[model samples]
Target: MDFSLSGLWHEMGLFARLVVIVMGIMSVTSLLVVGERLLVSFKGMSDSKVFASKLASLLADGPGRLDAAADTKFGKDIGYLGRTLRAGLVAYKGSVHGDKDLCFESVARALERQQARELAVLKRGHGWLATVGSTAPFVGLLGTTMGIITAFEKMAASGSGGLGTVSAGIAEALLTTAFGLLTAIPAVMAFNYLAGWVDARAVDISEASNEFLDLVARRLADGPSEEEEEGEESEAAA
Candidate 1:
């Protein structure tokens, strides 16, 4: 295709317009991902905080009291901590007069399940974000290559093989690279930020679970009074 300078500019301008449109779409997509991830994270955090608080109170009251107390109403928003604590507390109740090792195992399994569920929720948009981040540059490069090739072909046909002849092609190529970066940067950043927060939350859940188990072990071994045990349990859960 023999493209004149004016023709190349017109074509590249249209291509730039397309890049802008894609960038706008990508921006919207990135924001949507951010919003969705934040909603999940905030819900998790809110639930974790409240559930941990309730469990701390229950632990102080005594292992015997956890069964009845765990069932009170938190409605649908009860969150991960509630679900996890309820399962563990129930297991502890069953084993209050049974094998010590078995109770620990049940609670451990419950905690693991909760962690897995939370992790699944966190992972929802990560793949999409990564995909966009990896592919945006290539898309831009594609457009740039097309524009440049068209410009070069035009110059070759005209037999005017000077910088002026190919300038539009180079310009189009540069535009594509720039547009690709514009689309990619935010997607990459959001993926990293959300992933990091999720990892940190997982660590917190682990620490809380470990402390609860240790509290149970201590109360069993020490034969502490209910009041003392309750206080210790709250601190462990806390």
Candidate 2:
């Protein structure tokens, strides 16, 4: 067959095409992962905002916060945080003016549970990102090696191997390696960005929880008061 465009297309070997296909599949998988994680991140931010607001509204005591928050739409996702805050409120209530040990313990435990739940959500998809980042270059390297092998084979066949025989194979081989890296970079970037965002949000949530708890404590504090009539009688007697 003449080495025209159509000839090249028809003659292009299976390995070159296979490399392309593999790269294509990797690209699609990485994109899908990025999309899913982005969606989750956005939804998580929304859920966090809503959870904070609802919990703040009913933060007077454990029972009140629980009664108010447990039935909300974001219930299960943030139930642990709500329960933790409630635990603190309950501990304080049970010993309104008692030692800080029990209240601190209850709140601390609840906060830890809340952190675990949120961390789990954030940890999702990182493994895929890591896999892509680590494996993409190797995929490219394999393609390059295959291409080099083809070039060498063609060289072997022709007693006097020409540049053309090896160039095409080398080009095709390197393309796969390049292709792998192209698919991997974006995935790595997305993973890093999303992971950092999740960490920041977790910190924000922790701080917000502490702030709300203190507010509840402030509202509960009481001071003794004297009557106006008693003050007036004392003044008159003097």
lDDT of each: 0.72, 0.64
Quality of model 2 by C-alpha lDDT: 0.64
> Candidate 2 lDDT, tens digit per residue, 1-238?
3345454435456876776677678778878888887887777666656666776666445433432343344445543344445454455445433444555455556666666776676678888877887787888788778878888988888765787777667666766677888978887887788778778867775776677555544433322113324666788999
Q: What lDDT score goes with residue 195 in model 2?
A: 77
List the candidate 1 regions with Cα displacement exceeding 4 Å.
1-10, 13-24, 62-64, 90-98, 218-238
lDDT of 1: 0.72
The residue-by-residue lDDT of candidate 1 on 23-45, one tens digit each, is: 66876887798898888778878
Q: Taking the candidates one at a time, how many backbone clashes does each contain?
A: 1, 1
How far is 197's C-alpha from truth in model 1 (Å)? 0.7
lDDT of 1 at 80: 62
The per-prediction CA RMSD against the true structure, in angstroms, equals 7.4, 8.7
